[model samples]
Target: MMMTPADLDAFAIGFMLTERLADSTRDVLSVEPFEAEAGWIVRVTLADRCRGRIHDRVRHRTSDTGCGLCGIASLEQLRRPVAHIPPRPRSGARALFSAIAALRDHQPLNGATGAVHAAAACAPDGTIVAAYEDVGRHNALDKLIGATAACGVPGFILVTSRISFEMADKALVASTPMLVGISAPTTLAVDHARAHGLTLVALARADAMLVLNDPWNCFDAVAGEGLEPPTPGL
Candidate 1:
């Protein structure tokens, strides 16, 4: 995996959990990082209970920063089962908009470099409780997931990048009910989110957001709200 050299511990923990290499944090014993001639390396020690999940498969090359499903050897590997998200009370549009507005304040790294992506965990009322940033969008979300693992999943997760199948899958793995993306979502992501009961929203701004999937009515719908859709073929 090619990722920014920050929050490696979180990345390790999150990667373990999201990939189902370890069922929970209890399955992880330790995460240690060391300097290498090429770059930093993180060594994750999983408990004996997770021994069965370990594999010897190797990637031919480093994963690109924009793509997460890079090293899979077969189409079946990308079809991992997603856990269904239980239904929750509908989140108000006010809260969603509030979170969108507040997300900018939590992105210190992006503010400094103007190149990093951010992922944030927000409360039901739209207060951001935790946030993480990285050059890779997936890495940012992984860091946020690992950072908040002890507290359980948050009300929702917000990302500063387009929602792809991998991003939606990560949110599903974390059991987050809703995922709000600042940009649009891919069609595969929308289909997967609908199938797994994830409330997927995208094209979000301080004023509006488009609801691509809401199988469980996770977001309160405003009848006849004049929100413009993205351009055709987007």
Candidate 2:
């Protein structure tokens, strides 16, 4: 899940915005180089309304399925502390369908290694805004968030992997509010998405998708008529 410092920026932004952790979705206030264990630490400033949304945070890396869970007996970790989302309008199916299809074309890393996981932010018109790939799915998301923090705002994020708890946590930390995944999401992911005001969509592809938590956002599109929505187990 290792990536260059520059790549991590994009991971953070994509992870946050696509996951609906960031309502502002603005650019980074500033990016100062650091010598911490992680490549760098980013400081993002939000609008007046979103400023107070963040109080304290616990940041850590989630690499595997085991890393993104509760009661793991980790030294210091969260028991899933997240706020609620206000239910923003859902993104249309036509838009999502096109974005996911076109996302692969922009994946430079996957072009080389099909095994790598990718993440991207796309414009409303299906234009690929920013893209990043990493060995691990969570790292790809972290890079997306970092990228969004440095660069301008992105419309949404798309992941090549399944929606998991770590993905939800990273999105919450970034404060963006929309996440789309190629596969299904776990119960923990859905719970966190609802608590943190995130719109989590899973199994989105050619003609189908699911809305595990739509309170923060919905998928409204004329082209979505024939497509069936995914059913959350809970």
Candidate 3:
């Protein structure tokens, strides 16, 4: 995978969880990074129960910065079943917009380079609890998941990229109830999100957002304001 090498530890942990290699941090024994001839390499040691799964589950591949499913061996691997998210309380549209407004402030790397993507874990009120950035959008989300896993999943996840099926899948694996993307979502992403009970929002701005999926009516507007009407049966 191509990514910025800043947060190797978080990236390692997040990749493990999002890829379903490790259930949680408890299954990880250690994360170590070292300089290599080509670049930096992060070595993650998994607990005994998690060790065997790695050999059968993942196939190393050369992935570009944009594609998320570059290494999948077959169509079946791409469509691997994911568990549905647990039911959670409803969320307000206000919180989503709040996070959209605050997302820029948390992206130091993007501010400097104007070339990185960011993923943030937001509180119920849209406060950014933690954020991570990388050249690859998937890597950024993975880092965010790794950084926040110990503290428990946040109320939502915010990304500065389009919502692909892989993005939705990662959010679901992390058990975040909502995912807000600054750009649009692919058709498959919307379908997967709706099927798995994830609240998917895209084209987020300070004033309004497009709600693609709200399985439990979680993104209700207060006083009939804040969000664009969702498509029927999404």
Candidate 4:
């Protein structure tokens, strides 16, 4: 479509879920462009049963770049609670470190735009299984979550952006055990990770990185001592 974002596949699916645009991925029958007086609008064809749940009349909203979190109209939606954290089922921080090291391979879309964020799932073997890239970091994570919901939770998430509370919320929803990134984290991200039992690995370089959450459960210890993540690079 004329107005489609460069990352349409990911953006469409991600926006649908994160905005409560549809109940599931299948609800979106197709997406195309609609010429309007203001500009082109993307009209999504939803399943007939879901037609009334979400109206087609979209009210214009404004925000700065990277400010896609404004759709939260309800307190419950704004601050969704995570389920209690589960026990860490994997061993060895080596697996996580390897995933962080391999984050570059997951940026197929980012390689094109240099403006997209990515979220990838890595097996303990350190190979990326699935990656979703979007204009928004949280949306990227949500796309990864929606795609991975049935495959069962994996070892961790490799994000191409900094960790934030909303990122933590998406990871928790996917039941992902840990999040590794080439960036640092927000204070809220750290607290949410600890609260929900998800490991937060940040400031990852090729050789080393930091585990910035609850060390007792997150660290394998077998991989050695943990440290706080350094500041993120812009």
> What would the TM-scores of all predictions be?
0.90, 0.66, 0.91, 0.70
lDDT: worst 10-residue window of model 2 = 56-65
Candidate 3 vs. true structure, TM-score: 0.91
Per-candidate local distance difference test: 0.81, 0.62, 0.83, 0.65
Per-residue lDDT of candidate 1, residues 94-157 (tens digit): 6678889888899888898899999999887788889999999999999988888888555788
Residue 171, model 2: Cα distance from true site in angstroms? 1.8
Model 4 alpha-carbon drift over 4 Å, by segment: 1-68, 71-77, 83-91, 220-234
Once fitted onto the true fold, the runs of candidate 1 whose alpha carbons sit more than 4 angstroms away are 56-60, 220-234
Runs of candidate 2 exceeding 4 Å displacement? 1-76, 80-90, 150-154, 220-234
Ranking by TM-score: 3, 1, 4, 2
- Model 3: residues with Cα > 4 Å off, grouped in runs: 220-234
How would you encode candidate 3's per-residue C-alpha lDDT over 26-140 as one tens digit per residue?
Answer: 9989999999999988889998988887876766687777658887777677676676574573457777778888888999889999999999998888888899999999999
lDDT of 2 by residue, 127-204 (tens): 678777777777777776666655532355678888888887776655455778888788888987877778777888
Worst 10-residue stretch by lDDT in candidate 4? 56-65
Model 4 TM: 0.70
**RMSD to the native, candidate 2?**
6.3
